[model samples]
Target: MLNYSFPLTAAIVATFFAAGLVKGVTGMGLPTVAMGVLGSLLSPLAAAALLLVPSFVTNVWQLLAGPQFGMLIRRLWPMMLTIVLGTVFGSMLLTGGRTELTTVALGVALVIYATYTLLAKPLGVSPRWEPWLSPVIGLVTGLVTGATGVFVIPAVPYIQSLDLDQDDLVQALGLSFTVSTIALAIGLVWHGAAPVGNLLTSTLAVISALLGMAAGQVMRTWISPQLFRRLFLIFLLLLGLEMALHGLLRT
Candidate 1:
């Protein structure tokens, strides 16, 4: 069992709080932000374990906030199933003493996600292509999530491209995130990385995240969405660079 000093506990709370604030303002990024910060101090799998419960609860709230739950689930089932399977396979590898590779992979994933956020315009996908593309994206995203515990790259962008109404889009993201979180949790447990004792700390993280989310909700009305997004992307870019450098140098 790992020991948690006062400073470590404080850092974890602060990190999750900030991550949740970003999620509240942007409708995404809790895992991304949490992983980026926590990965610096802990192994990728450990960081992932810490985030499981908080991500699940918040996403559940987001998922239930809209009315198209059944519709979205039906349309996205193939992708969801593929995500789960891919995550299982990837988790097996991650738990097999591949921490260094997983850290590098997380860094690369973050850089790619940040680059896309900075450069990509809003894309629209034709309905005709959804059947062919959704499963592929889901599989890739699941693999990435299983290895690195970050699930927002290809999945988030693909969902955004669907051009659903704002409510549906939010709900879709929530559904995807909720599923991904649960799947990741299961993966962690399967790998023996997530123990029952972690649940207490995870619950504390949930509270901090919720408080931060409430504060961010108030700030959302004051901040312009475009500006907030740009700032968010910039932060991710810096964090990604740091993680990549650290991982490379350490290796």
Candidate 2:
């Protein structure tokens, strides 16, 4: 078994707090921030597992927040299908021997994706792209999410690029995360990674995440969307770089 010290525990608490705040305010970012922080202190697999409970909880909150069940059901089917397939594929490859390689690959791809989103301008696509393109984004996001826990960053740009209004965007982010979180949890279970022993740590992390989400919601009214997006992007880039270095050097 792995040893978790008090200081590390404290750090994990803080991370969850921040992650929850981001998710509550922006309608996403919990898994992204939580995994990034936990990835630094724990094995990448553990970090990935840490996100399961919190994501499940918050995604449910997002799903029930508004009366968009019909819209979500309509648009989410394709993405859900893709994630189901991706999860099966990811489950087959997970093992102790592959952990380091998987972590490194996830870190590298996340860095590239984060850079692209941060640097590139939004594409002016027609409505035709919505059904066709969104699933592709979902497929890629699911594949990464199945392999690691860092799928949200890449997934964010695809949704943000759509030019959805604030309400639509919020609802979309909430639903996207909700579905993805469920998919990821199922994948982890299929892969035998959801042992009961993880419950204690995951519970603590979820509490912290809730606390953070509350804080973020309060702060959201004060910060503009543009600033929030930029801030999140910067945070993601830094975390990606840090993960890359850690994965390459330590593993």
Candidate 3:
């Protein structure tokens, strides 16, 4: 049996609860909150690994169980491919000796991404540009995942700009996170971060995330799509700024 100190246990519970609500209401954000809080306490490597399992599980629920599966698959396939390839490329970079720097970069990117999410305008008017734009988002998300085990926020605006209804948006976001989580898991194994002895924590996170999702579902009816968009972006901004300052000063 694995045991966490009381405070750590409480924190994980809280983190997962919040992560779930974010996922339920918006269709993503589980690992963002998890990594942000956990990265501060554990080695970035460990925190990253710990986040992988729950994220994978949560995305399964969002992508497969959601209402827009077929539509999302058709619309988001190109971006999904980019995410897969980019994460692989990023993970390969960690094969040698870039662990520490990757951690720092991870923290910094999280902050920047968070800030960008907050201030960015409505997405550009052209889906025609998305094919070109997607790879960039995918590449950055992959690099950040490789370095700090986080990604998603950098890709949010792109997804949001599509003006997907809630179900469609969640499906896309869920697919993104699910694919990234799978890629990161492979990367972690390559780098020896897998078979991590933290399954207990991961299990706890999953449960909390599910509960959070349920709660968010209850609240979802009350939240306008516009409100969801504004709140989500604002939250990302604050999260990003917090990460930036923390990473800069920590080292």
Candidate 4:
């Protein structure tokens, strides 16, 4: 069993709460924020383990809120299948104790994701190209998730490029994240990173996240969405830089 000191426990809860707040406001960022914060204090594999339940639960809530579930499944099944297969293959890095490499990959993924958020124009995909492009994005996103426990890089952007309307975009993102979370959990269990004993702490993390989400929803009306997003991207940029430096120096 993992022993938790009060400070460590507090830090973990605080991190998840903050992450959840971001997710509540932005419709995404929970795993990305949580993994970026927790990676500083824990191994990537351990962070991934703690993230499993909260990520799954929160995303399910998002997925259920949107309509056209059957259409999304039919449209995105190939990409979803590729994500699962890619995660299964890439999870070997985590299970093999390649901490430094995984850390570097996580940092790279974060930096790329953050940069795109800050600099990229809104992109749209041609219907003719989506069939080919989607599976490629899914595979890359899955590999990143397996190594780093972060799943919002290329995949989210790709989905956004499909030119979905506001509601469909939100639903598509939730669906992709849900699959990624489940795949990551299964990978961790297969690799022996998440044991049954960890469920207690995972449950606590879930509660913290939910509470934070509630608070954020209440605050959403008060804050400017544009400002919140800019600040959030800045945070990701700094965190990514820190992780990258640490990973490189350690390696």
Candidate 5:
């Protein structure tokens, strides 16, 4: 696993900045990007630790800045609560000696998410079904998050199923991601993977992430979002393929 000799290594900053840049453009994917870039050099737990602050800060802002804050909370509280529970329950897999398992899980998650996004048709859920279905999705999403430090798979897809406008969907994503970050933080601490000891490096990562977000925002204006999304999914598919292969071959 990678270790830090300096408080603020350029590698950490650059990795997070690149991750933040992706989230800035796409409105999601900080953890996915950060995990992919850093997981090779460090264990997944250590990489996840470095991303905690950036993910939390950014997602909190995304959550609060939305017009649907109160309404979304009321609608999503059940799912959110279940997500927390699921994380704690699933923390059993966040142990120190399971790097290969986590790596394989991470790769599988990326592949699933990218493939779903690219090829899956739009799905819709009725208002009546939301009462029961929401919690189920939350639990499953949380378990996957606990296992792999990446928390987008079913959660993002489920959130997309809700018939929300663009802004509302973005806010919903922020809400889900914020909860996942907190849950992952707790799970990491429970497993002794928390970056509490590396306070300076983690703090600096937040700054780098924010800077990358700013650049991505600028780039967003210059490019077609549809095109960018397509390109991003393709990149993820390839990245996930390589990761999965590497882990399986190593094992």
Candidate 6:
């Protein structure tokens, strides 16, 4: 569908598998990992298209797997709605010709979030602030997602501030990412960034991603998740830096 060569298609499949493996091991980072890798070669819009199915399917499972879905829905619905609104209003940045800008934006987003993850102390949000702050964060996160195809800046931190238990936290991420993915997919479709033929390719990528997740589950028994997560973040930081610098130089 993308008209890439055999080797490139193989590489994309491998990329998806690896991304899904990270999600299986870390319970997050599939889109982050995949977009950081794919964005270097493809337009952010194309990478976003390729990411839709795997991200949605996996996150849906993650969202449903936890015990607090109904409660989270009640609590986070406003943020979710705002993410959609922001995505629709901002999708033009992604679908337009400013490929380098989007790539740079994607790279910067990765660096900021990864650094925050590795260095930032845990933060808390007052319950009094959630009513107003959550929607604002969602709007910004959605705009960033619409412009750059990455969605883990204020959104992730906002979710963390809620101080959820480990299980609920994971499920919350799933819901957040699922909303982002669905909204992004709609934007892409609305602008013809994802053509009908691309669905076949995206669906195939889902298989590779699931297989990678299975492999990761097996590997999870052999090593420490904390170690893997640390290593993964460092890798992401470096990749983001390289991508950003490359974008800057090209401009």
Whose lDDT is greatest here? 6
Error of 1 at 27 (Å): 0.9
Once superposed on the true structure, which residue ranges of model 3 sit more than 4 Å away at CA?
Answer: 1-3, 92-103, 221-242
Error of 6 at 141 (Å): 0.9
Query: How would you encode candidate 1's per-residue C-alpha lDDT over 190-209 as one tens digit per residue?
Result: 87878766766887799988
Best by TM-score: 4
lDDT, candidate 3, 65-177, per-residue tens: 78878777777777777777777667665444554555456566666765676566677538778767777777777766766677665677678787778778777888888
TM-score of each: 0.96, 0.88, 0.82, 0.97, 0.94, 0.96
Which of the two candidates, 2 or 4, achieves a greater lDDT against the reference? 4
| Per-candidate clash tally | 0, 4, 1, 0, 0, 0
Residue-by-residue lDDT tens digits, candidate 6, 70-99? 999999999999999898777889899788
Q: In model 6, where do residues sit more than 4 Å from their true spots?
A: none
Off by over 4 Å in 5: 1-8
**Candidate 2, which ten residues in sequence have the lowest lDDT sum?**
88-97
Candidate 6: clashing pairs of residues: none
Q: Which RMSD values do the candidates have, in order? A: 1.5, 2.5, 3.1, 1.3, 2.1, 1.3
What's model 5's lDDT at 175?
Answer: 98
Task: Report the lDDT of model 1 for residue 234.
Answer: 87
Off by over 4 Å in 2: 1-3, 92-96
lDDT of 6: 0.89
Output the worst ten-in-a-row residue range by lDDT, candidate 1.
92-101
lDDT per residue (tens digit) for residues 1-251 in model 5: 13575533767778788888888898988888887767766677777777788889989988898998999999999999888888767766755567787777778888999999999999999999999999999999888888777889799989999999999999999999999999988887776767555544676678889998888888899988788888888888888887788877777
